[model samples]
Target: MTATVAIDSYFTPVPDEIEAIDLVVEGALPPELNGRYLRNGPNPKPGAPPAHPFVEPGMVHGVRLKDGAALWYRNRWVRTSLFTESATRVRPDGSLDLAACHANTHVIEHAGRTFALVESGLPYELSLDLDTVGPCDFQGRLTTAMTAHPKADPVTGDLHFFGYGVRPPFLTYHRLSASGELVQSVPVEVPGPTMMHDFAITEDYLVWMDLPVVFERTELGVPYRWSDSYGARLGLMPRKGGPVRWFEIEPCYVFHVGNARQDAAGRVVLDAVRYDRATFRNEWDLAAGKEKTGSVPGQMLHRWTLDPRTGVRSEQQLDDWSLEFPTLNENLVGLQNRFLYLVGGGSVVKFDTVNGERGVHRLPDGAKPGEAVFVPAENARAEDDGWLLTIVSNRIAGTADLLVLDATDVAARPVATVHLPRWVPSGFHGSWVPESVVR
Candidate 1:
């Protein structure tokens, strides 16, 4: 059986529609190209798409979006000559320029009037705004592929990014000024060379979840697969800046980023989904006469809390079925209260983060959800009192659309649906930004 579920519903592409922006949605290294000798060879499975496509790229790697407008990253380039915008690419200064950027599993944002973290290095703050998409050093070496979902401190306005240190795979944090300068850089120990994914931060601490270890071999054997032998840890790195500490978990239970909040008891609460491996085995060496096989558990969704001062923590598993991804929406109902949301096999759930209470609603048959955003309710008194924006692709139709849900009563029908002109490939992650803050 496949590790990840198949895409049940996918939307159709519009061949004649004018394509505006392109983003990097998912990544993978196909089997034929990942072996010890051959870097990129012919497909091992003829006519079948590789497990990972981001490792090898096609032309037109990056997508450009203007202020307040967001685009989905399609692993493949969507080309169109028809236009509301110019077909010939131009620089931020309106000069004729042709450049392609390959940004897989990284954050792309326009903030503080001008600046962008395009490639996975120091974020280059620009002098121009969204209209002036400035030049970026496309060839810069990355210490670690920058993870998406960067958080800006509400108190200090400092943007924090989590990355892997290249020479050796250690987790590192880079703080950027509002002006886009790399103000500080610090290294944190994460036991293994965690992949470019699986790291997060809150007001007081940086959180690194169970990440995959990159072996000495250059080949990444499986797409989006983590080890069953190495134990996964819930690690914490202080924002004030200090040593990294890890809390262990049974290996094979993978973690994904959700909403994080501090509780009244001085503990930080994280909502993460953990999945069990499909296979497991313990092997014994004849000479050593010892046994060692990593344990892979069944799928579980859990809420974990950790105290930095005392290093104490607790965990509570929620759903019996799989809970793939969970996101926290603060102040959706009100700034004082917060809600936790997640997408599973065929449903979306909204729960009270403080308590464990929640509401569940299923989606239309065959609709695969991408990232989500919280839009304020149309009016204060409306049912559910908030809007949940999700991008779902329909399998039969082969088309993707924006689905607006009622957060208060998620089971309630969709309030609005924005149909896009083409299919949007699945994306790893994304977040929302208010229009007022764009300028």
Candidate 2:
């Protein structure tokens, strides 16, 4: 047999992106927030290798599929083999293993081909041949930190990922080759070493929130912390390198980093959710006025825009509800380009930002919407004719199904449903991984 290339062993450092910036935003975490649990959960121990089952379908929490498959990333708690055995629920004989679950998402594209996946908490790129159940790692660790919520640029086809890290704390980045190799990586500078909660990137820039506070491992072995600001500020970085501009979000704790979209006016508008004083809480049993925990009742959407030319930012409040996860389907843009979308609390509302009004569309009763994938009407119409893909799980059903809805009419109903054989727990992040893009 011919010798295989030792990609992982070769360590040639490549200079990274042209522009980058760290921004501090105002935001505090309540006990109930998702990040707190990852740090302070009872189990910190890693687990065994994952078992890729033939029948047990996969679902990603914070990832979306561009073609039809979803990029699912698991934490350390749910062991991989366990994920294979009892996908929908925990088994009595099943033990929880963190290591097996702590992996990036892999794509099993058509014709038994497997594409590599790069995710947080991993040192190197993950090359998974799902058909043969073989896995490989690329050279040098791309991220020593646990990256969170990576979004793929539909146009550039680059995977943009960001998240929390330690060791004087830093943000890490790796630009992957089409073959899924770690072509470049470097220490990405963020303002204040603030824990980057989540980030979204479009063709132009990377938008994220930096909360000031190093995460501490709780006595119970759970990682947790209290941010300096009840809210964090928003910042922007060109896909390249430069001085990062940090923007302050007034009157609200901009805890969660949402979507960054550009309007017809060439202005960039960032859509996110902020938990005010009433909605913020604390936990960790830490003393000295630090007993805040649990999320408040309602959540709202806040939009901020910056002039591309002058870098001047203008802010506005878009909509208020129990609104959590916000997605804008800018498939068509005209004077009346309607943004077809949905919220975390389960309302499908269309917003005409140009007009400044909202049209509400409700999902089928009892269908809980998680992170939704908006297949622009243009893309959806070309391949699948026209259908929006979404993963919805019902408590009673104990399963997550890939549901497709008509992009034009949110109230129309699901066009097709691919029932996932396993139960994917209520998760925080997810994305759409299209098959055509993967090699």
Candidate 3:
């Protein structure tokens, strides 16, 4: 007999596509809020769940706002070869079909195109209306899996991203011109295959995390595990593609990076959520719905300052509480940023890194908030001048709400709460595409 693995609370999937028009708003919507708020996450088939939650099929939930009204809401499952085919098939070369991607991790817009992304496969293109446009190979130039988290430079409008695989040539870097052309792809040298989910970019260099979580054969569903033999380090590579300078750091895992910038002294500063080896394994098991083993460690807000001249790295914990899904002003990517927004521990928090002050907006009892996305106000003066948008799951009510809070005052009452029709399962990352980009 086999023990049962319980499905995570967030694994529940909606039965069918849904559209709601003229949703009722609890408060006033920002008059300048004109755009779409889209989030992507896993939604497995009704009877056939994937071996791991991360590999499940993707569903995108979106809301359109214009003229200070909730114009519409729609949810659609991304159509890919994986979801359409009756049987799993492999190419003649034995490589998995990139078209058969889950595309469940994130939805982003670049080069006038919207893409649904899963780090292990190619990105599926989608129209502004939230309709799947099928797999895209960037004009047949992208041959590797695309990272779900791609950073668009605020100044140059270029997109900087990378892909990591379980095979050799394990890491590759890609860059797209502001005009949306795949202009560069360079193979990055690393010791072994590690789970490189997210990376950061500074004005002068790219920051890569080569952690200890390596691929291993296993009888269980997810084959990747933390290895004591594999060491942890960070790589600094130039934008023009050259030899990478590696810096050794303490063994830990970083799933997301808040932001990175180069200080006046040319030192690289990175802020992220860091988890120790023990905490990472336990959290991964819990997310896979495996039985509880040891206690899970909290994801701490940490900062690393790397001095290239001295070849030394200094790390510090900025906050003691558990948090994840960190976001900052998109315009501040690769630049100095004052506030970092994150969701977890039943609240939306705003951390002032310079002042060491934190503000939290607590949700209703038994309710949880997803990632908080920042939308800058029209004619924005300050970095924090915007509204924070997120889906709040009301477990007690069996529904969800699109809560909008003032970015500068997160602890204040929500400026608006647009009711959602169903419970949204907890998923990964998402993006806010302004109407200017849509048209």
Candidate 2 versus the native: TM-score? 0.61
Q: Which ten residues in a row have the lowest lDDT in candidate 3?
A: 1-10
Colliding residue pairs in candidate 3: none
Worst 10-residue lDDT window for candidate 2 reads: 33-42
Off by over 4 Å in 1: 1-17, 20-101, 106-144, 210-213, 216-225, 252-255, 279-299, 330-337, 377-385
Off by over 4 Å in 2: 1-101, 104-120, 123-137, 212-214, 219-222, 229-231, 251-258, 262-267, 277-295, 307-311, 328-340, 356-366, 376-385, 396-400, 418-424, 431-439
Which candidate ranks first by TM-score, i.e. highest? 3
Candidate 1 on 300-373: residue-level lDDT in tens?
A: 56667888778887787765655555665533211123566777656777766556676876777766775455
- Per-residue accuracy of model 2 over 293-317 as CA lDDT, tens digit each: 6644565666788666677888877
Ten-residue segment with the worst summed lDDT in candidate 1?
34-43
Best by lDDT: 3
Model 3: how far residue 177 lies from native, Å: 1.2
lDDT (0 to 1) per candidate:
0.47, 0.43, 0.87
Cα distance off (Å), candidate 3, residue 85: 0.8
